[model samples]
Target: MRQWRLAAALIAMPALALAAPCELKIGAMGPMSGSGAQWGLSMQSAAELAAAEANKAGGIKINGETCKVSVVSYDSKYTADGAAAGANVLAGQDIHIIIGPVGSIENAAVKPVAARNQQLAWNAAYANNALEPRFPLMFQVSPPPAVWADLLIKRAMKTFPMKTVVIVVPNDQTGTDVAGVDAAAYKHNGVTATTEFFQRGTTNFAPIITRVLATHPDAVDTASSAPGDAGVIVKQLRLAGFTGPIGRVGGPGTAEILRVSGGLDVLRDFYWYEAVPTDDPKVRAIDDEYRALLGKDPMGGTTFWSYLPGARLTLKAVQAAGTDDAEKVAAVLRTMPVEDPNIGKGYWTGKKQFGIAQGLFFPFGIGIIKDGKNLGVERQEAQPE
Candidate 1:
């Protein structure tokens, strides 16, 4: 009888290993509506793709059980209060990792709430104070303007010479801070910069365009303004007969700008910064990987590719930590080498300005359109100068 019982117990051990899998929840966040929708959706798409990839590969392993990766998303409505609300909502769901809250306002509001909830969040905020040593759990997702604005401005100057520039941005912390950095870059290159601000929700920009034209700037830069707003500004500026090169030193929205500004003909002589080298074969293949995992076409533009590596790295940290605890995951993230299968190797930089070496620095791209001709994006290696 004892030998029979031992034989039954040994046979049942295999069944225990094959039990139901657990769930590993990760949160995706950003503004999912209104003008800033494109940026937020990109973060969400990247998060979904990463989770799908992890699930396809047998999910995340915690303890001895295989856990299926799940993504929860929130739309912060492009406001500080929205992000704070989203953080609390995700925390209520027991989510310990969050992927975004794209703008400066959103990031600032969400950081404290996330820290209080013991959550690790990667933000796409380009604000001056986006990263701080005090919030060890908060990380900057992409290289900010201070990191590459000089290179972008120098390259744009090569294509379109200018002694003075007017940057149009929304009246907000992100707008003001980004414009300040971009203005410094222009000043360093011997070009005087003046910033023009508009209310966040004004549809028609004729008045502001008139004000911007009064300065007679050689070029106009839509620095950190939403794509819809930038397009309107570009359209109105062209209508106002200011036929100067339009440059965007803030975020990646060339496609949206073109669409809103009536395509390349209207946006002729345009130069801007793209978050990623969208033309590279290896980089373009990121979409193919997305299709393989998500079974859908990619959404948004450069941000989808740009945000992917951060989401991948976050999950990698979760796996390395062997648990979803924010502190443990953050510890693993700080120690792990910055690299992504899609975006390739990156750097753990941001100490000079932010006082924390937690920002992810990746190679960026410069895009140009000259006289109605599309001149594809050129890759710029990440030089942490």
Candidate 2:
């Protein structure tokens, strides 16, 4: 009788396992390799980690059933074409709602595909104004870049009284947008800036640095995406004997600057637009998990900030909607609250802020680069800057 009872229990194990429902598929897209791979990879990893944790907690409860969440990640290669292709592929799948392809460029590419399929896309990167012109089935989770500049300028003015400022920007869409924001902020702060713009891959900075030095500016700012670009720009300025505070609103955090610039000492006195607060328990947990798994801090802020929130929030929306119906799932996501580790908790809406319904709306966090090696997070704010 004892043996028979044991056998019955063993036989029921398979049925119990099969009873667990797996209905929803969560998909993410980003560049997992090449020059822009860091952001995509980090977001993908963070999203997957969140999904796994959610599943361990008995998955998402919807309607009368509990469904397990599975994640699908695609590499957009940081190109619009790659983003579009990934979106096309995923649109053909059974995913309820999609998280991201990290880069603003990728987001722009994928937006149309998402709209066609009635899939809701959450823009996870910084304030990507270029994507503003296109209206799609998407919402933002952060404030715009204009708001980022507003916050930085406000803080800097309070911290240091400045008379003359210089604004340097990359000749890309991002740089142009940030440069405008900085200019307006400086004007509002009772300062006039000497503006200069450079092409994205320009190897020569001596002339531009020399020109800025001759003006004897009190502060300098750049709106470039690449950490190496910002680091090299600052180092070149230092080598040219310019002794002013440097701040890059769009640059990677201090760690990446330190790695590529040979050391952070040469570029110690700068402020960064940090997306996540270092003190947040969630942020710390992510850092710990990322370090444990990858053996390094996630390289780019854009990657982690965009990917994790996109993944987590999208999952929440799917769970809320209770089914894999893309339209309904996306609709639920539009109304869900975003409790992002990076930006704190906020709702994503693009229509009111960006003047377009397809852009992402999210919060921005600020940080300071003290000494030569640390990124001290300042604070998280709901305002755009």
Candidate 3:
């Protein structure tokens, strides 16, 4: 009887050892097919990179078992209908953690689906104040417009002493919301600001440029303008003889703007709200890895900094909570300090503004483009109003 039992145990040992590790699927939902395809693709790429790194390091540990991370992405086309469909698809795949639905309009559509599924969503785009109260599980990892706007205005005032500013943004809801926040920030900083909206897909910015320059403002604030629109506006503004400061308040689009502007050196002296400091060892390492994997530098936007760091923070929270449970991970995220290479050490904020501590409050990097290269010069911490 003893010999028989030993043989049976030895047979079962192989099966136990060969058991497959639990798979953790992370959903990346964004505009993977529209004009903002670069944004969505970058988000997907960053999340994949993070997952690949974790897998290399033996993946996430839970209950003494290893969980392999996988990022499953879906294209939302930057629309409400598309976002809803994408959310449903991700939910069907049993993905509990979603990276985006990039714009506010898309996120608005995704909120219900996320709430219904009880999924933890990290908003990779700008923080829409309206979404937080309704969707408790949705968290905004990017700094809110209020935070970045404050920094932009301060830097503009100190460097150029601007008094009157003209804000131009897309005619969509996201643009309207950002313009409001930027207007408030400018007002608080002792600057008068006016806003002009342009329809999405308006390639010719001459009319808008003429009208904006006619205002005789000290600076033109492109508050959260789409990458293509921003490039055209900058190019036209320079061509139209507007020499004052141009606030690229909508994160750095250095490469895109340069490409769109026909390499015209239009972004010189622009106050960009974010840029990866090339001098930082961590930033360089990430860039190197990204270039190696993607065969190109990260899109000239927040992708390099936002998604990768957000992924790192999410995994850290999962490790801390000891499970992939959304509530458990969220609880850990609320108290965790994010020390990623992109945003640096910071805590989750936004209780006063959004009635939830879901926004990542970190030092915003302000940089300038000189001779066609972005160089991070100053860092501003988010201050309470």
Candidate 4:
């Protein structure tokens, strides 16, 4: 009798395994406890929201079985070592889809681990060139600095036409790249630009403001400044008696900039690359939902819009490929057109630029702030052809 029972138990093991529900784990890794904490937190929140919505709709189908989705987040503290540690932790848990490591340095640290593990790294930040060839599994979800700079400068020239402008950038890799792109864009548009670099943790912009004003520039471009730093620099520029137009050549952070500058009144003649259209009904709905979930307004930057499409694209690719395999999903993504609620419609492109078709090219909105109101203007595919 004992031998017979043992044989029956061994035969039922496969059946029991088949009865278990598959857990599809997605990882969100970025700086959650440093100067860039807000950006990381926003990315994680957006990923969770997407997962929750998918699970509510009976989850995603994989291998002819329904699998429940889960988002696991790790704080990388915006450091190289921290990002590597976080990547290792997620890779150990068999997480194949990762949302972000916002900066270039952090992304560089996590790239090897993602490649070794054959994981998909969906980068919502880090627009430095030559990323796709280095890591086939990595996808750039956000528009690069060159794209935004070109649009902003072109619009500014057509609308305001400043002959000479001053550019302020943070002293970092992203800043350097943004500065170079902005300078080139300005030159191409028949405008001259003088650049100034400030330390990352700079609190006082008086000296920089003084030097910038001394240049007698017709406009000030803070295309590479972080959200907080942009606010400080703009406020100081206003107080220092320079009353020209201000252009932010980076992603939108208007709400935070307004708050940091005390009010919208200080931001006259301001323009920026908006993450979403101000009048898009879909954006309003998502923003309202996000506000309810977080007890505050959504992030004023691309953080609020970048991750949703990535998550949606991942889910769609998994459903289409009928498996959760990273390579298969990535292959599907290369040929898929991504149309999310807030991010609008876009397709993956970059064959000539990055040596791979891994970057999302979408129509981005350019917002003009006048008298505390943000007005949206659309730009169709500002990227190079």
Candidate 5:
């Protein structure tokens, strides 16, 4: 009887190991297609790199055992319904932590579903209520306009003066949240600002460009439009003989913007926001590391670099917590220091704004293009929100 019991117990041990494989799955979601594809792809790329780093180091230590880290990516399409479906999909797979949905509406949709599913998500959205106290698991990917927009506007005006500006964006939550803040920043700097909106997926921006030019503003700002849409607007603006300075106070997509806007000649006298210190050698090394590990060049744009710290820190937290459970991970994440090897020192802010000190604040960057000259990017400390 004793020999038979020992054999049955030995068989059950294998079944238990099969039930929980020696692997950790990290979930990544974003708009992986369309004009906004760059932003979502950046998130996916960042997560993939973080996982690769962990796996290369023999994976993260969970419960005293090294488990391989693998990334599962999803295209949330930057929509509420899309994000909801994505959250359900990841949750169904027993994924308790996620990194993505880089738009205001998508984050709004994701938070509720993540909460219901007892999952934790980090969103790169700049919406007003991106990180609420109620959703302790929801964390901001980076600081919003209120933290860096004022300085960016000041620098831009110093480089290229503007008395009036017209900001164009999509007629969606992402547009609304960014346009309002960008306009406020412009106004605070004593520049009169007006806003215009176009439905998402409007390929031809001639009508809006005409409306923008009719105002005869000193500059037209592509506040937070997708890089693709912003590029078309810049192209049309140049074609319309609008030679004044152009501004981009939204997301990082200067590479894509330049491609769409017909390069430096057309995008002359441009001032925009960047999220990483591209000029720093340490920061630039990330590109080399990414290419070396992934065997391909990084998805272009500073968003990918900016998104890295969050993903890296999350993995570190998983190692420290020794578990993938959302609540435990959140607790470990809160106590962990905000630091990245390439990006350097940062802090966890958002206590005043979101009632939780969960937002990631790192040094930001501002880029300039003057008279077809690429002046590189300048780094600035991200103030506490």
Candidate 6:
């Protein structure tokens, strides 16, 4: 019996040695095919970059062992249903945490699924005060759209003597949310906001533009999605003879906005609220690397300044947590605040950005398209008024 016990112990020792000392997997979901595909794809690359950098540095130390990281990516095609489906699939796997479902509507739809699985979701586009009451496992890094809306209104009020604003939003739920925030912000700022809704695929904005133009508002505040939608709206507005500065709140297509706008010099001085800036050194390095690797500037895809910092923050939290357990990592994430150069120079207090005050949060950067082809970023610190 003693001999048998010794042999069994020896056999079990090797198995234990081969077991991963520690391991963690971060799941990323985005629209790789649909309208929002560019944001999703870009985020995946950024997460991969962070993961690779972490692993190359000898992985993260967790508990008493070094934890290896694995990245799992899925495409949500920019739809709420798609996001929920992708979240379900990823949650079914042995993932330690999740990164995104790019848009706010998608985030809202899938956050409950993450809660059901007792996992963490660091969604990219959610910044609403309302989210706190819903999903506890879910956190948003971007400033609430209402804040951006207020900033834009303040900008317009200062830059131009504008008295009225016309708001255009996507007819979808996400767009509706964007409009709601914009209205709230305008009211808070002592300005009146008139809103209009449009379907996602609608190309002809003649009627809507005409109606808004009739309102003869001092400026047009657009809350549609990406460059494609915003570009279409701007072009149609211009064609309909509206010359006021057009603004977008949540999803603005900084990369392809010019191209999609038909090079009509419409966006020459166009202003949109940006989450980060492209000029940060770390962001610049990543952009340069991407340009070298892709043989062209990564247009319409993930750009360093736009959507990837959140991924880096997630990885950093995992590294900081030093464990693969979802709950443990989630707890660490709730309190992790990042000041990465790539994100901007401002500060994002985790308490203000995340409901639990223990998740990852970073500063928001405002960007503008200047001289036809560059994103000029500005840093501002303002709480929701």
Best candidate, lDDT-wise?
Answer: 1
Please name the candidate that would achieve the greatest TM-score relative to the true structure.
5
lDDT (Cα, tens digit) per residue for candidate 1, span 8-95: 9999999998876699988889988877888888889889998998888788877767799988989998999999999999999999
Residue-level lDDT tens digits of model 4 in 1-385: 9999999999998999888678888888877764466667767876777777678778888888888888899998777788888888988998888887777667777788888888888765534662668688888766666656776778766667689998898777767777877888889888998899998778899999999999999999888576777888889999989888898886666666777776767987788876555456666587676665446665424456656677778777888888878899888877776577665777666676667778776666777766555556564443434
True lDDT of residue 327, candidate 6: 71
Per-candidate TM-scores read 0.94, 0.78, 0.85, 0.86, 0.94, 0.81
- The TM-score of predicted model 3 comes to 0.85
lDDT of all predictions, in order shown?
0.89, 0.65, 0.74, 0.75, 0.88, 0.66
Clashing pairs in 5: none
Question: Candidate 2: lDDT over CA atoms?
Answer: 0.65
Give the runs in model 5 whose Cα sits over 4 Å from its true position: 1-21
> Which stretches of model 2 miss by more than 4 angstroms?
1-23, 33-36, 60-68, 92-96, 125-136, 201-216, 289-307, 340-344, 347-351, 356-364, 370-375, 383-385
List model 2 lDDT by residue over 1-385, tens digit each. 9999999999999999888565566776776765345566665676666677578778887676787777788888767798888877877776546667565666767777777777766555453453454444565544455656667767766655677788887665556666677677788878887688886556677888888888889988865445555666777887787766777655344455555556767766677675555456666577666566446665445446544676676667667777667666667765665566555655545555566644444555566655554456676555321
lDDT by residue (190-298, candidate 6, tens digit) is 7688898888767788888889988888778766565566777777887777777676666545555566777737665556765654445665677675555445554
CA RMSD per model (angstroms) = 3.2, 5.5, 3.6, 3.5, 2.4, 4.3
Q: Model 2 Cα displacement at 74 (Å)?
A: 3.2
Clashing pairs in 1: none
Worst 10 residues of 1 by lDDT: 337-346
For model 2, the run of ten residues with the poorest summed lDDT: 127-136
